[model samples]
Target: MDAVSERLAEVHGGIARALKDAARTDAAQLVAVSKTFDADAIRPLIAAGQRHFGENRVSEAADKWPALTAETPGIVLHLVGQLQSNKAEAAVRLFDVIHSVDRPSLVTALGKAMVASGRRPDCYIQVNIGAEDQKGGCAIADLPALLAQARDAGLPVIGLMCVPPADVEPAPYFALLAKLARDHALAGLSMGMSSDYPTAVLLGATVVRVGSALFGGRG
Candidate 1:
């Protein structure tokens, strides 16, 4: 197998083991984060049966994915980074799921864009579980209001998403996010990454954003 295929196999193996340990077989989905990587690097993983891929920026995705997806079928694209209100229409057109709907304004924009484009991608409310200044997520106290806005605007919101503080143990944050999703009766939890996905699965993550593990470090 090629390098990317090998890495993908290893990541899939890890996911399987984690699910089996958690008794959560098929409960979670792995979103191979393809941010910063070019299409050449991504094709092998697709050949290896990776269906879900995530990109951070709309412009970069626009540059490659239209042609890529047209050539390859069954590829689900996810927007796993901060989104601008101005780009909502483009995002709705390209992404199957958006994992960074953090505020009421963004929720409104996405709803409007979805209407305009006749596309409603599943959205995940990003919660700043760590409350970090540099991070892009709704404050924990603001999650309810944001979620309400999304629902009122008829957005197809699926669940909650969070990125834990890098220096701290991530389990607590993941657990808290799962609890928040449950409290709101949301069905999806988009949490975890290369370092802590297994822990996330154990803590009830329905979607894990794994980048480095599958594609190596971002270029």
Candidate 2:
């Protein structure tokens, strides 16, 4: 096996063991962040039973989606980047779940795209828990409005997604997301990455996006 394949095996085993120890029957879903990598790098890992994957760019994901799906049937695709309004159609067609529904305009665009495509996709409301201006998530105060918007648009509100600030500990952020999910009565929590997944898992993260840990550093 290649290095990526080997790393994926190790990571999967670690996640499984972590789940067992945590007594989490779901043990946090691992959406391999396959943003920078391509089919060649991901195929082996998929062949080794790693299915769910995430991507950041609509254009890149559009290119990779079909080939990857053909190579590994039943794989779930997630969009984990800042989704632009213009790319909403492609996002709906390509991703099974969108983890970056942060803005009202974007949500409306997605709803329109779903109407045109005749398919309503699952989604998560991204929360800017860190209050970072440079980020693409909604301010925490705007979540209820956003969630209501998504619900009214016929989209299935899966849960909350966020990228905690660089310096802050992720447990609190993950914990906050869990609380928010409980408050909102949503089922999924898409938080954490390679660096903070353990913390995220501990704090009840249902979905964790890990990239470099599975496929190594991006170029």
Candidate 3:
């Protein structure tokens, strides 16, 4: 097998093991994050049967995905980075799922954009699980209000997404996100990356955003 295919297989194996250990019959969706990489790098994963992919920027996704999606059937694109309020319309048009709905203003923008474009992409409220200043998730304290705003605006808020502080044990953060989702009656938990996805699965992540494990280090 080629390098990408080998890596993909390894990731699938890891996910399977995690699921078995969790004793959960439901499958966790793996969103292969294809942010900086080009289409050439992505096609191999798609050919290897990866349907859900994530991009970081709206413009970059627009630049690449139109042609790629037209050629491949059943591709679900996710915006897994912070979205600009101004680009909501374009983002709404391009992506199938958005994992960074973090604030009231952004929620409002996305809601309006969805109305204008007639496309409602699945949304996950990003939580600042680590309370980091640089990250793009909503503060834990503000989650309820933001969620309420998102729901009122008619955005299809499905779950919660989080990126824990780097270089720390991520299990607690993942567990916390899962708890928050449960508290809000949300079923989806979009957490974990290449480093701690198996732990995340054990803690109850319905969707894991994996990038480097599948694509290798970004250039």
RMSD of 1: 1.0
What is the per-residue lDDT of model 2 for residues 1-219, given as tens digits with 9 covering 90 to 100?
A: 777678877766766766776788876788999888878888877877888999999999888779768866799998999999999998998889999999889989999999999867789999998889999899989999999998998887888999999977777788888998999999899987888777777777888899989888889
Task: Please give the distance, in angstroms, between residue 149's alpha carbon in candidate 3 and its true position after superposition.
Answer: 0.7
- The pairs that clash in candidate 2 are none
lDDT pick, better of 2 and 3 = 3
Cα lDDT of candidate 1 equals 0.91
Measured with C-alpha atoms, the lDDT of residue 56 in candidate 2 is 95
- The true-versus-predicted C-alpha distance at residue 61 of model 2, in Å, is 1.1
What is the lDDT ranking, best to worst? 3, 1, 2
* Clash number for each model: 0, 0, 0
lDDT of 1 by residue, 25-77 (tens): 56789899999999998888888889999999999999989988998888999
Q: Which lDDT values do the candidates have, in the order given?
A: 0.91, 0.86, 0.94
Clash-forming residue pairs, model 3: none
TM-score of 3: 0.98
Candidate 2's C-alpha runs over 4 A off are none
User: Compared with the true structure, what per-residue lDDT tens digits does model 3 show for residues 1-219?
Assistant: 988889999998998999999999998999999999999989999999999999999999999999899999899999999999999999999999999999888999999999999999999999999999999999999999999999999999999999999999999999999999999999999998999999999899999989999998988
